[model samples]
Target: MASKNCCVMFMIFTVAIVQAVSYDTELFETAPCDSNACFDALHGALGDCSCNVDTIDYFNNVKIFPRIQSLVSKDYFRFYKVNLKKECPFWADDSRCAMKYCHIKTCSKDSVPGYVDEHENERPAEKYTKIDQTACSTDEDHNPDLGYLNMTISAASQYEIAKWNAHDSALENFCECDDRDADAEYVDLSLNPERYTGYKGPSAHRIWRSIYQENCFRPKLNPYESFPYVLSSDLSNMCLEKRVFYRAISGLHSSINIHLCSNYLLSEKGVDFAAPPEGEWGPNLEEFQRRFDPSQTHNEGPNWLKNLYFVYLLEMRALSKAGPYLETEEYFTGNPTEDEETRAAISNMLSVIYSFPDHFNESAMFNGGSQAAKLKNEFREHFWNISRIMDCVGCDKCKLWGKLQTQGLGTALKILFSSQWDSLEADPEQGTLPVRHKANKRLQRTEIVALFNAFARLSNSIRQLENFRIMLSANKEPEVKRNVFEGGGANIRSTKEQCSSGGDKPRIWS
Candidate 1:
């Protein structure tokens, strides 16, 4: 009995330790750098890695995607075009780009006082090294980005440049040996101008007509026979679409880097908006105090409402761009003939799907019963395409790419059970106005019930991506692939069953 009790205690302790450990903790530990480090270290490494046009051309052909995906998400590579220009120091003529204006003053090592030896020969004496020597510099010819890029590229083992590699320590060298591939290039922008001269802003599509007329269409079939041949719009349009996708994806990702999305995930139980104190107007304290007495009206409603509203708008815009691409029959099913274009579109879609939840998790504040129902309808229509992609591309690895679409829908469903929708909409000053104003602004109870039902259906359709990743990682067998999609419904039901025990209460962001 004593031996049995000791064995039971040991077993319990082992299970407790195992349960306490995180699956991702080890995965991240082996990663070259954390997310935060990637921002600065990668920036610094790229600065060093940027060589002249020749080096740029060489790296453009190199394949790093296969290596990058082992640790980092492949979505990061889409920014390669912008990164090539922004991160790399480009000189049309690398030789002429000089920093000859810089002048330096140095102290001579022999200038230190010396001690006399027995043979009357002067012996050198030790002296402190003075690093404060002033150096004259002219800003007229200095390109700091180029200089830094050159210096980093000059280091060995840290980065790979044209005939140059950084020989720095692992910690100092962000670029590993596997990052280098001197062979064929994976990205080709040879036809499109390296830079888009048109209004390259968030709303790039608006200037598409102007861009096409000026830069895109003019190269081909010029009246003058002397003009060189130009590539058709086939590649150019893809590049433009990718640019829009990149900007859209970057905007959403920037929010994550800012730590605005630390709390929201599909697994989260509730989302509570940070309600600001009532009677306080943003940006005008004096006007707020004069217009409204603090004692009369209620203070502190949902503070995150305004931010969540903006996030919703941004999310909608991103989804609008990504949705059409994913919906296209050709893109959903792989194009065997035009594989590159299909792959690019698929990559963009993945970025879009991945970023949706990051922004959608904050969207609980803006959701109403009707909105939830519409989302549910969209999810049913779209889930098949998403699932098709997952089924074809290893469902365990790719399901999250599809399920990210319905996270907001699930949140909407959960929130409807205990909605403050009526209270929020009834307040005249709450600024619940839509883009277009209407006579009937409030949602009906039937719509709310429909929304709850919709969310329920959508929620049941997909399972947690993180769980799938863990399962797939643990079980390498091919049988698990089929089991994953089928098993998703079972897991969703189980999760719902657990949540039902808590009375399906709308959890507010705490």
Candidate 2:
């Protein structure tokens, strides 16, 4: 009995020591990199794309980021149309999230500006003219600046009336989701920001699991295995197209995790886990570490982070390619001043992106001998299916962002790989390809919004990563204590004790 007790104590002591070492290692791995070293680390050939991370970092921080922020906040880009009431096709369980944060507050039709009800007899152009006139006249201030703004806005509205194309039904081929459903409604994206909603556990995991298992074109390894394990396998042997698919999905996953960590609800002394309280929200370093630190994420953190950059470059390349199309599109929201500003911001963003010498070459993809066409089709189908899976997500907020980002990515793929690129006319003087007017190939307004917004999300994630690194390096992270229930939920223990004893499994959330 004495010997057995000694053996048990030794095992417990060993676990404690190992857990302590692991915690220390995680901290060390996440320590902030020197400025030069960090940029240098990001410099590499990601798949077919080669870019200087320093250049991307500088452009995004100084030039493009601010413009994207401004553009997304504009009237045209702020509203998103989605069918939140769609049932999950994969499973019968339609129990949506119960958490308050999980639900999105939708905008009423009356509150949405420039929204044209199909039941009304008035044409969109005429309605927009009325709204624009009202906006210009309502202001009490008759200053010269206000007059200039109104003039610019009116001009923009007139220009949009001449050029704007209604939502194209044929463009639905690029997106898998049914956006034309009568039940669909416009959501004010600014009001429903993507943040931590405490929607985690089996439901969240199942969604990602289905995505990776059914959608990603990976070799038949164990399909039931965890994502990190499957991702960390020998990906070097995979074909370029397959690799790109996997990396893009992983990049999106990393971005979602980053958003959650950046805007996590900090645990306080009087925090109640039973109900959703308006808790203090800020960066939670421990949550960041759990999702991203190499020591905790099966050594897949660095790879996932690198993939995030790859996706950014891929989407940026698509934007660069679609410059002519974007420039021609009108952003009319009935508010002329805001519409003009939106166009200017987009133009500035494009200029900055165009100045960058290194952009991903779409031609490098889908070149696998005789199987190239087949492979390309497979790639498109897989991404489309992934977009469809967004409907299965239990959280309304997560579903909203998921559908937008995925649709955006799908649009990028269409721009890159579709036959539409062949139709672009080259302008020798401009040194850019201007999109030829093809009725079936033009990008829809929703797609344009999704494309830029998705890029903005990825850019923000990269910035958040840097912020978290600084916080970790400065040792300014507050210790978050989680309550561990014990003895039939009567006794409470600290997360420290749970960590030391190896008594808790890692919590993976979306």
Candidate 3:
């Protein structure tokens, strides 16, 4: 018993020592996703979102492998899987579900200085039966900026969202080709305006839901959209890969959101910028551009195009949050306009949701206002949209109640999306690509290390973003909050802390 205890203590000490030392990029070389090993680190860091197949080739032929590789490589681990274990943790020690080996062996170890740490023991997966192998070395060409590559992921998602949005917008735009509006915009995708015209334009609810749908399946292949945007494969084959990837991606997104937000607030130029004023809450506006021009500095994401797309993503997402959750059918079509009760419900819902903008500032509630508020708002609208559709299908509420319900639901979503900083922070991990925890036994420590490292990089990116916000807007000292404001927004409230007159703080309008 004494000897056994000593062994356990030694292992613990080893891990402790590993922790104290700076975790170098090389320390995780065994991380699987080689070429994009940092991405490999992301999976483990975020949680688990690994392979389910007994072997990777279970369903993949050479062509399929490369295709899946591209999808996996370009898309990251935000896909679904069937090989997921019955339990959450592989080492859970449940006799009934104990891990069974699934043949994913590595042949040789690298010899570079830190490529493989001095070996303690090795496994047949390597060539030795001992446990510790040299620590993996850092890739000489590791690019820290790879963390910012999230925009590429975002672009993939946006492209997916845009296709659907464009489709809906097309239909709506086409519908407006009526004689009463011949001069009105037609279904020209080219004329896709950055701003909504209140009277016409794509529905924000639809856009948000569409993005959520992609996000949901971002790691998992939706049997619907197969590749660049659609899933051409059968659900069975797709689900396994889809689920696996979705888990990882969502987790990654969460980390990225947090890291960026925190960094933005702390950066030199970040806090120097401010949420300008009314009609200028991070929207594409000339006034907003002018407000920061004099004090503008570099070291932030510069391109106007990039900023524009991000703004659109935020607005659409926020608007989506502002919507009432409607029935499946209502998700596409407007909910019943027939019953007064349903109508009232929709109206009330909308009113309540639009009210969130007034409550937030630089305090702790910022993220709640920026991200969460919108999410809750979207859920509320989803409820309304579904309720009305259900109402038409013979489940109508009392006339007054239905209308109030509809209105109330819409109100909630609007308020929810209007200023969403806090709520989004709550489950940022859930939406990231690689989700935490899974059932696969074959997926092991090395991959997890890779994934975890990726997540750390993402976390670092967010920190950078947070830093940016503090410096630019002069938000005093910075706190490490999720969702950096390196992205833009016009402040609606004054912080209790006074700023030098005309600093980045928004000057509240009378």
Candidate 4:
């Protein structure tokens, strides 16, 4: 009897050990790393991309970040044309952000550059002629007789110039948003930055939930399954195109969260907004940990951080591929001096980006057997749908950025996988220039501005991660506040009433 009991006990212990091992394995495969481990292990090659994450972090942090920041601050990149009033098509809810910070200040018509506002047909040829004439007049050595040679050109030449200035309508198929809407207004992105907007709860959650559930091809998992388990299983079997699509969205989401954390409104006490101008804004260490620390976020933080690097490489690859076109493309904004400076700045930035050793290979993607074309089209359509979904974002500032970044990613996809390459190559004369130059006239000015600014935003997020890491290591939690508003309870009561009515709690801004 004793011997039989021992045998049964041993068998039970063995089954329990097996189950424990399986659980551990699943956790490792899904989460992969903790905060410290992620920072240390961020060196390897990223999924499906040729570049190393460590290399990206180093170059972007040290060499490229400052330049890109400066580039985006320029006139040509600062003003963005977007239809902020577009209604949400997904749901009937038209909720707006209650926070004052969520509002975006639109540029007055007179504030926008004249050249940017000019129609293609009315581009004013004299502007180009004046620039050329000014340069010739300033030159020390020039033939007196050939001086100021006829500023006028033939009709054919004028037509060619106008064609060059006009945006390629075909690229619109890649992006779903109607950027040319007559109702669209110019918003100075410099004035309105992406940050903590007290925009959360059911409304904000619905936007992301819909995006992930509807767009990403993630399978429905068991209700009892852990998030890590679901994440691991879904990514394990997905094809390259699907994974790229998923990662791109995840990366963008991660970038936005990082921005909010970096620029959180920590205190409203005693702080005088009128005196200092800007509100009390700085990094919220506790918020960062809550969102990204593995211990706090159930091991999902590292995956999101990794996806952010993937997006940086993806956009970097696009910029590298389009180097030839970007180098020669004009950044005219009605000011000749600033335009020349813009060109030189872009040229220098491209040179530094081109120095990177390995880049994401655009050609390796979409090579899946006969279904390749179908998969490519599906990928484009899915992204197009995402671009449209941006219109549904309730917060004005959030929608502005959501549209810009999605459009930027869509532009990157077009550069990577579009069939326009074949048409460009078919012409012998066009083929004489490098293949990279094929994007010269294909991309719109808005798309170009969106692309570079979006990458700058991602780059800033990556750089800010270090600041967050240091803050985390300090291990100090901020003191609890009685209220977010000044004068404690009285102001808090009024603020709550302004945000909502009837006794429903207002969404807290951390």
Candidate 5:
């Protein structure tokens, strides 16, 4: 027993030492780089670090794989998976080569010797593996402004959001075309725009229709137009590889939303270049841009995008908190028209379904039965997809409610699939069968409406939970009580503990 205890103690001691060393090494490597030391080390670093590890073909290697097609064709023909590895740490240096594997000096003063300790051969540079330099040039020329790439990204994002908002507003006006309009010199627009006008504008409608088709519909149908704006500077005069362009722009729009929210908070407080008014609510601009900017060395774009979305949720929480304190929080107000847009989309979809006989016949005549059949399949698949989503979400209450609502529709669908269509059409008004089928269709419609309501409620719940997680992460308080259910307060200290420890699994919709 004594010998066994001695062995156990020794094993524990060994494990502890190893863990301590590993933690120390990680801390040392991640330490902030000293500017002067890094400069000196990088300058004195002799030759290009050779890739000893086996390298696979990197499709984003622009030099080796030059662009042969135009930018339009490039979007269609582009083929490359996003490289999630950290960019080359020595991005500004000329000696760097585009490789999957290379070492980077950590630039820590203790790790890499300062000028005073340079002669002593005491400190050695740490080797950083998994540096992706697919965007780096093979030539000796290095863009001096490479360091300011993140800042450039932030500016470009702001520009894109502003442009998109203006474009969206213009499209809205075009969609609301009418002839009963006066000159724009001094027109007092009503708070609520009339849904219907008693006048028609065939010419104006035609012009707006053409513009909408060209701008919005065309972009949706095309590859190139839909491609996100790649982040490269006019100042740097650098051309990005196709993969780099795609990867960089993946989370850019989402990041742009974050930037706008951040700017709004700043503007509200009447201060510029300050921390978030909520106090470290989420990652700051620099940290956010660094984490999500695919151009950066340590880019965790996807993870950072998720984090930024959480930040958005937090911002929304702040907005809600501010609401009770005032009549309205002007800065981060919700879009009032979203519910209208949803209802409009659903109404338009239902109108199409109701008028399918005439529309399908016309489409069949013009574009063949295949086109009509494709659309029919799409509608059929949509219903099935909803069912699948409900199943996958594993929400028993939702599924139960769905079944209760669509029991008749389920029966009708069964008969439609099993029964001969020709026979059914021949017996047009077969007793109570037709009546039951109509009732089934009506019930299906009700189910769809219920599903929409459920989706909204569940979405709101998920957002609230995400906000709660963020709060738990930020707050040091041990116990926090939350009203998760109506008329019930739950002690969520365990949930908070789980979140703080990063052990909480992603929640499934109930």
Candidate 6:
């Protein structure tokens, strides 16, 4: 009886310990980046496994889709687990506070700095060593998505460029199957004036058109003729449809500007006039009081909102030029160069998406030139394509999609808008924060549901998890499969029954 009693006590204590042991997610809430050990214990490791464009490109082309099943529904958890481990240096992963996230005290236009090193009050930032990830090899059981996020972005870019050039013969030449294998001479980017013109800005497509008219369509067709990112339309038409291409570009840029998004959201310029605040006008604001009482200044919104606008301005200036980057051999030569034309073009186009708030700004696209609701539809079409790309890589928690759909755009929407702060603040009376509006709204919902949906038939169950793993292993998560059952219920009864269909079908992802 004495021995049994001791055993019973031990069992009780053991159970308590088990229950107390937290998931990586829980640890994120309790303690974030204060200690390096905290991130390690929760996120698994903290070696130099940072990601970049080349790596992302490689993964998208090879392994990203393969790791979706194992961790699909766990995006919220993953976000917590990989917060400091995966997202830091550029941003904070403070899992404890709801309001503080990906929160950087200050940011630089250059590479993001380590958080703890910059802020003594903050926790230790996770640092990675190196990863020996290859494009596609039958090697390990680790998340294949982890290995190729950048490649996925590149592939998506290729897909978008292809869609734009679908109508032209020369445009077709720019693809993999072109007659001269237009993709082959990409090494000569510097020499091709039409394709490689160093000029870049909002009018980049114009240069592309100039190239086509002079070379590609001019009689003999120089087999060597190349135009930077083939043009699908004239400059004005491209600008009109800029929202289409800009959607993806905006996503990519927002991803690059992740650290600044939260701040941008709080900016007065971030909000669309069509979408206003839920509250009534306040009286105590110093700026407001000053305006009404005299000898005072008009404070339209908070500093966060003002800062949000500045961030957008900075990002837009950079986004407008995303095109020349393709013209530089960098797109093909795999080098680095961002021309003014490309940036302007990218910015003008992307502004349609990120500048969604501006379109509705009771001010109406006066400066942005957008009409109410015109860009909104185009925004969804663009976002849908981008969603498919991320979906292929096992990412479904994307905030941009919800924003594009107006299905309650989340804080992630901040990433999709441009800085209209100047105009807002300029009003001296009217101001808003779409960035905060979107982010706060998104925070109200579960962050990981869609990530699970990204994987086909991933519901809550052992069978579902097992099926998911197999599909991810083969990079087949995005591929369509024939399920044993046909259409049955009106909606899904539960997550348990959504297990993936067995293999054998394939379709174009985007």
lDDT of 5: 0.23
lDDT (CA) per prediction: 0.23, 0.64, 0.25, 0.65, 0.23, 0.23
Kindly list the per-residue Cα lDDT of model 1 for residues 1-510, writing each as its tens digit.
Answer: 999999999999887655433211211112121111111111111111122222221221232122212212122121111111111111121111121111112222132112111122211111111232233354879865565422221233322331131322221111111112222112211121111011112122111211122222122242312111121222143222222222222221122111111111121122234422211111111111111121211111011111112232333322332232223323211225443454564455334334432222222333557865553333232212211221121111111211222232222322322222223222133222121222122222222222222222222211212222233344332221112221111010000000000001111111
lDDT of 2 by residue, 210-309 (tens): 6665667655463322332345465765787777778787777777777776776665322556533555556666666655555554455666777777
* Count of clashing pairs, candidate 2: 1
Query: After superposing candidate 2, which stretches have Cα over 4 Å from the reference?
Result: 1-47, 117-174, 220-229, 267-277, 368-370, 424-432, 478-510
Give per-residue CA lDDT, model 6, range 203-257, as digits (tens).
2222122222321211122221221222222212333233223222322222212
Which residue segments of model 3 deviate by more than 4 Å? 1-110, 113-445, 475-510
* Backbone clashes in model 2, listed as residue pairs: 153-336
- List model 4 lDDT by residue over 398-467, tens digit each: 8888888878888877777775543344223221224543533456677888889888888888888866
**lDDT for predicted candidate 3 compared with the true structure:** 0.25
Give each model's clash number.
24, 1, 199, 0, 1, 58
RMSD of 6: 31.2
- Rank by lDDT, descending? 4, 2, 3, 5, 6, 1
Query: Can you tell me which runs of candidate 5 are displaced by over 4 Å?
Result: 1-369, 375-379, 382-449, 458-478, 484-510
TM-score of each: 0.16, 0.73, 0.17, 0.73, 0.19, 0.20
Candidate 5's TM-score = 0.19
Summarize candidate 3's per-residue lDDT along 78-147 as a digit string, tens digits. 1111111122111222222111111111212231112222123321123321233343335777655563
lDDT of candidate 6 at residue 32, scale 0 to 100: 18
- Candidate 2: Cα lDDT at 301: 66
Task: State, as a TM-score between 0 and 1, how close model 1 is to the true structure.
Answer: 0.16
Per-residue lDDT of model 5, residues 346-389, tens digit only: 44323322321111011111133676445333323322322322
